[model samples]
Structure formats: C-alpha cells, structure tokens
Target: MATTPAGRHIRNPQGTGGRLRADILAAAGRILESTGSDDAVTLRAIAREAGITAPAIYAHFADRDAIRRTVIEQTFTQLATVLTTAADTEHEPVARLHVVCHAYLDFAARRPHHYRLLFERHRAARGADAGPAAPDVGSIVGADAFGVLLQAADSCIRSGASTAVDPVASATRVWVGLHGQATLQASLPWFPWPPADRLATDVVRRMADLR
Candidate 1:
C-alpha cells in the first residue's frame, strides 16, 4: 500500500495511480458483475470502494461511462494480446484458429467478469462518451484479436484450402462461432459434459474444413 501525503495508506501497490483508477474500475466492475454490467454502476458506490471523493474521478475519467469504456477497451486489448500470441507459431489455418479460440475461451473462463463487462453490458452510468479525441480501442484491439485468424484464413482461401474462405464471412464466422462456445463455457459450464478442447477443435475443423 502506498501512503498518501495525508498519511492515509492507499491500496495501490503498483504506485502507478492506475491502481486507484483500476480500483475504481474494479469496483465498478463488481457492481456491474453482481447486479449486471449495465447502467447500475454509480459514482458514489465506486468512489466508496476506491476510498476517494467521487468528484475526484472527473480528473481521470470524464464520467462513469468513460470509465466503462476504458475498462472494456482495456479488457479487449488484453484479450487480443493473449489470444494473438497463443496461436503465434501454428501456420495451419484451422490449427492456428483453434489455438486462438482456446485462448479466448481460457481468458473468458479465467476472467468472466472482464469478459462480461466487455461484451455483455448494455451501457454504463455517469456516462458520457470519451468522444472523437479518444482512441477507438474497440476496433483497434478487435482487429488485433482476430488478425491471426484473418491472415490464416486468407491464406487458406488463396491456396484453395476452403472454398468458403471469403475473408469477411470467414472471420465473422470464426468470431461468432468461437464466442458462442466461449460464452457458453464461461457462463454455463454445467449444461453438459464435453472437453472444451475437443469440442472447440471439432467446431473449427468443420468450419474451416480442416483435415
């Protein structure tokens, strides 16, 4: 914990002050997670969790929705980085895609809260968009997240590996299909029994026509 000038101990061990910001984001995530990651988050509750004046949030985020966007964007960026790397070495389209899918499922399973906050939330509170000046982190990292799959899928199309290899369709297919499995696995793991890897591999093989 870092000591503030006022002799109060801060929970931020990283010393980046992002710890405070992260705490606020985390608290907001908690509210959204417990209630639903929608418009339920309030500045007062988040401020209480972060142990600071609510208005102080204005210094960092323009409003509550701004923090939501930041939190979701950061979550996607982190997912993109992880899933992108998970399939780094595999050159085969289907194999590479499977690894990426597994990486995504693993991430969602481990951080269901972040996953839900990023994709499931309807909107946020105290909300105002960060605006034109702010980076569109959604498209940015989303592109990265699926970049490997696109590259490999395109290669398969060029090589006549899959006649269905239209880039947009293929990319969208993999994304939707992968997200379905990941979402199910993360949110409702008890519905039935099948190994995630096996089921995911079967899905990818069928979709990509992998041998």
Candidate 2:
C-alpha cells in the first residue's frame, strides 16, 4: 500500500484525498437519511457505501463523532444558504421574514432525514444537558441560520413592522415555533396540516408581531 508524504497509509492510492473525504461524508449522509438515526451512521456502513474499507474512513475522519459533526455542520450551512437566499429577494422586512419562515419549512420538508438528524435525533442524544446554552449550537461553527432569522426580526422591529422590543428574544420565539411546526409536519405527514404557506405566514406574523 502506498503512503502519503507524511507516511500515512493511502487508503486508495488511485483516489485523491479530497475526493475520498467527500465520498465518505456523502456516504455517511445517505446512511443517516435512510436510517433516520445517528446510531446507523457507523464507519463500517459509510465505508461500505463509499466502496472503501472501514479503516479508510479514519484517514479523513478521526471517529464517528467527527463525521457526525461534519455532517451536521454541512446540513446547517446548506440551511443557512437557503434562508439567506429566501430573505435576500424580498425588500420589505415583513415580507423577508415570511419568506425565510417558509424557506425553513420547505427545507425541512424536502430534507426530512437531514432535518431530523440535526434537530430531533441530535437533541435526544444530548440527554438532559441540552439546554439553551448547549454546545450543539456552538459546535455548528461557521453557519448561523438562527442569526439570519434574528437579523430579519431586528429589521422588522426597527422599521416598525413588528412590535417586538428585543430582536433576540423575538427571533428565538419565532425559531422555536417554526421548529415545532416543521418537526410536526415532517413527523406526521399523514396528519392534516393547514396550507404550509398560510401556517408559516401566520406563525411568523403572530410571533414577530409583523404588520
């Protein structure tokens, strides 16, 4: 087996390091989505999906948790992009807020497994210490999806479109409400849900006190 300049075993001497890493992450994502549980996202399963041996995963990820962390970060980064795009198109603060809310719901609906992995399963795994100050948010690192919502709420409050005095508090309330709606919709698709647009708009308006 050929080794890199640093003397580490090159799992696939024919494959570039970056490509192999991406393949491993993608494989792990598939397993997480299919199983809808973190427990199933094992190194062996990812290796099988990636057509590599289990030890090869270690070349890119230190352990299962590292892969899990990367997957969550990537998911949140994508979500942040979606939310940012949704807010950018609308000039009006209230309209932007509504668009962002709908975008979040849409993302959750489209990526139910990813959504569950990030919000549901991950939270449960944190046990009783997963409070507001939990490290999960900090662990996400670069992406700040919640910050996008906060900025919109802050703009609305400043523009008099919303009566909320505290942007952070208002945004947190809106986020909590949106999370509940999204999780419920994803978890209970068979249950009757009001039109998504209407429900999302109503929640945003009521929570943000949007005019």
Candidate 3:
C-alpha cells in the first residue's frame, strides 16, 4: 500500500495490474469523500490523491465520470452492508425497521461526503438525465442499499406490524421520508435539528404506522 501526503492509505501500490486498479478506485473514493464535490474528482486530483502519476489513473478509468461511477457503486455497496447489518440484529420486523431507519440516518450523518456525492451532487451532475423518468429503485445504481428498506417493510407488513397494503409502495414512501431527513440534516447541520434518535423513530413510526 502507498500512503498519500494526506495520510490516506492506497492499497496494493506495488502489486500487479488488478491491484493497481483497486488502489485507483480506493484512492478516488477517498478523494471524493474528502472533497465532497463531484467537481473535485478529476483524474489529476485522483492521481495526486492516490500518490501516483496522472497517467496511471488512465490505465484503470477512462475519465472522471468513470471513476465517479465506480466510487458511487462502492458507496452504495457499503451502505447496503451497513443497513443490512443494522436490520439483521432484531427478530421482530418492527424493531428491525426501526434499526434500519436509524442506520440510514446514521450513515448520512457520519458519511456526509459520501451521502452528498451519491445522492445530491451525483444527480445534479447527471442533470436532465436524472429527471422523474429515471429508473425505479430496483434498477437504480444504489438499489441494494434501498433494498434493505424494501425488505424490512415487506417483513413488517407480513408480520402485521404495518398496515400498508403494498409493501413496495409503503417502502417507497418511507424511503422518501428517510432521504429527505438525511439530506436536510446533512445539508443544514448548523440548524438546531431535533434529537436524531427521536426524529428517526418518529419518521419510521409515522411512515410504517407500526403496531
């Protein structure tokens, strides 16, 4: 692994071809998370962040968008892991849903940069292409992360903890609420927001109407 001047480690620095590619992606993720802006994710910035020459980045990524796409994918995968882990700890569907909701908020609060890049800035970068006609949650880039919530909502409905007639539609509503809260909280941290735990619970309870 190679350590950048910013003290972030890039794995597999001296390794073979695949390793270099992995390191490049990892480095780009670090830069994206640190900079918290799609505009800062240029190949040159990624190369500097990765502690390699600019040309080395080309070996793995075709352009800035290519690296951003990979980083977005990685971020979503990480989010899915976190949400799944949080939800798996409870047996009751209602409890699991609560945990999952809290986990989503926590992920955004803790990784504001990643959340911004994945949800906010990335969509803006896509411009008109990211309009209402975009693919459904199941086919989106971060579908797995949202899938955790969908599964939790389905389980809640099955267990009679939720009154929603359609699990997917209910899950979509809950997701919309969660995303709004997460985005607003991350964007306006200086505002005197309510207690996170209470707000998260309230959002989940109101959306699922858990019995």
Candidate 4:
C-alpha cells in the first residue's frame, strides 16, 4: 500500500493499479449478473465486493459509469473472440457463416443477462426519437464483434457462394435477423421456436443470399 501526501493510504500500492481496476470490474460484473441491474453496481458495492474501501475505487475509476463502460467493452471483446473461434471451425464460406450465426444465438442463450444489458442500455441511451441504437459500429468493441460477420459475408461473396453484392449491407441485414431471433428466443423461451441451426441457416441463406 502507498500513502498520499495527506497520509491517506491507498490499498493498491504503486504497480498493482491495473490489477485493482480489474478486480473492481469483476466485482461490478458479479453484482450486475446477480442483481440483473446496473443500478446495483454502485461504487460502494463494488468496493465491498473487492474487499477495498470505497475511496480506493476513486484512484482507479472516475465513477461507476466508467467501470460499467469498461465492463461492457470487455464483454464485447469476449463476444468477438467467441465468434472468431466458432467461425474457425469451418473452411467453407457458407458453412462458416452458418456456424457464426449459431454461435451468436448460442452466446445470447447462454448469457441472457449480459446480452440484454448490451441492447437495453443502448436503447436507453438512444431515446425514443431515434429508436434503439444498434451497437456503435465505429467503436472498437463494436467493430471487433460486428466485423466477424462482415468478413464472413464478404468471404461468401468473393467465393461465389453468396449472391449479395454489398458485403456491408448483407452483413447488417444478417445481424438484424440474428439479433431479432436471439432476443425473441430469450424473452419467450416457451414459444414454439424453430431449431436454432435451421433458423441460422435460413437467415444466412436469405440475408446473405448464400447458395
């Protein structure tokens, strides 16, 4: 631990600040998942969960929103990694796209809270006038996650496997379909839904024009 000029002790010391920040984020994530609400991820709660004083958090994060934003960014990276790993399991463009779509749905089904947090927060941010905001494609987190679909669609087009001319447009449409399916399935688990793989295959074939 280190002491400031005023003799207040800082729990993280000098070189371990990054670790403390990560701990704070992990604590916040746990609170979010447990309570299923961002309101519960207050600084005091996170500090308590991390076994530190509330003042200690101020040294690492400006406030609760900073920590929450970092958590969301990390979550997006995790999603991108999942999609990339799924896509790597196949070589053919159409098959790769199908797997990636299924992977997207699987991620939602497995982590419903985190998935809901992503879009729910965006909708709250967008206000009613603009409608729900899709992930910001310009941000690094958004680009990394959505870029996987763009690459898969482009591959299909280049390989003569897809009839779509514009990869970006096709990818955007496919993403909308996947998002709709995932959200609906999660919110209405009792609904008679088609097989996930079949739904994903149909989406890829229709949205990307996969042959």
Using TM-score, give the best candidate's number: 3
Instruction: Estimate, for each residue in 1-211, the C-alpha lDDT of model 2 and write its tens digit.
Output: 3346995544455457898898788888878778877788888888777777888888788888888777877888899999999999998988888888899889988888888778644543343454755554434343389888888999999999998899988988899889999988877889988998888888888989877
Off by over 4 Å in 4: 1-15, 123-140
C-alpha lDDT values of all predictions: 0.69, 0.81, 0.80, 0.81
In model 3, state the lDDT of residue 108. 86
The deviation in Å at residue 33 for candidate 3 is 2.8
**Clashing residue pairs in candidate 1 (N, C-alpha, C atoms within 3 angstroms):** none
Off by over 4 Å in 1: 1-23, 26-40, 122-141
TM-score each candidate.
0.74, 0.84, 0.86, 0.83
Candidate 4's residue-wise lDDT over 114-141, tens digit each? 8877776654333335534445565434
Per-residue error for 67 in candidate 3, Å, reads: 0.4
Query: What would you estimate as the lDDT of candidate 2?
Result: 0.81
Model 3 Cα lDDT, one tens digit per residue, 73-105: 888899999999998898889999999989988
Error of 4 at 192 (Å): 1.3
RMSD of each: 5.4, 6.1, 3.3, 6.3
Q: Which pairs clash inside model 3? A: none
